[model samples]
Target: MQFTSTPRGARLARRLVSHRLDEWGHPYDSAPNETLTLIAAELAANAIRHGHVCGRDFHVRLIECTSKATTVLRIEVADTRTERFPSLETPTPPTVDDESGRGLFLVSQLADRWCVAPRVGAPGKSVWAELELNHG
Candidate 1:
């Protein structure tokens, strides 16, 4: 899905992701569903705030893979600013009083694995996170 690089766009991205997760057998209130949605929201917001290029939009892709052992949900958000890559290596937690700067930190805590990569053949970067489903 493609969205304009704005607050409204970020919100729409999160909502759509929630709906998709629900359709994919993960209920809206499920732990994995909620966590992934929040992760999507943070990445989308970062794309808008840091990766936004005038008249350019960001993209979100959701993929699910299931195996005998586990099911994994992958979320990718791609934006048009190649120079402003997400710092997955050293995402230090923000101070308690700081309202911002905590998005990536929360993602690292919630996602089983997450990273930033160059958007294949695109000028920007894609930030991706994966969550392994609980079989119980």
Candidate 2:
């Protein structure tokens, strides 16, 4: 889904992610649901604050894959700014007093795997995270 580059849009993206996960059988309070929702929130907020371009919007895509042993949910947030890709290496630890710069750090901690890549057929980049859930 595409969203305006604003806080409200970021918020909506998060809500929709949670709702969609619920539809996919992860309840609102389930670990997969809450974790992915928070990932969406951070990524969407980062897209708005760091990736925004005038008159341009951001996009979010969620994909679920199920196997006999596990389920994987991949969240992708693509934005129109190409110059500000997050570091592929470990994110530097933010200072205690720093109020920002921890979004990707949190993502790294929560997601089983995450990365930044060039958006396919697009001018910007996509930051994506994947969480694996065991069928229980």
Task: Give candidate 2's error at residue 20 in angstroms.
Answer: 0.1
lDDT of 1 by residue, 88-131 (tens): 58589799899799889988999999999999988999999999
- RMSD, one per candidate, in order: 1.1, 0.9
**What are the lDDT figures for the candidates, one per model?**
0.93, 0.96
- Of the candidates shown, which would achieve the greatest TM-score relative to the real structure? 2
Candidate 1: what lDDT? Answer: 0.93
lDDT of 1 at 55: 89
For 1-136, candidate 2 gives per-residue lDDT tens digits of 9999999999999999999999999999999999999999999999999999999999999999999999999999999999998889988879999999899999999999999999999899999999998877
Per-prediction TM-score:
0.96, 0.97
lDDT for position 31 in model 2: 93
Residue 111 of model 2 has an lDDT of: 98
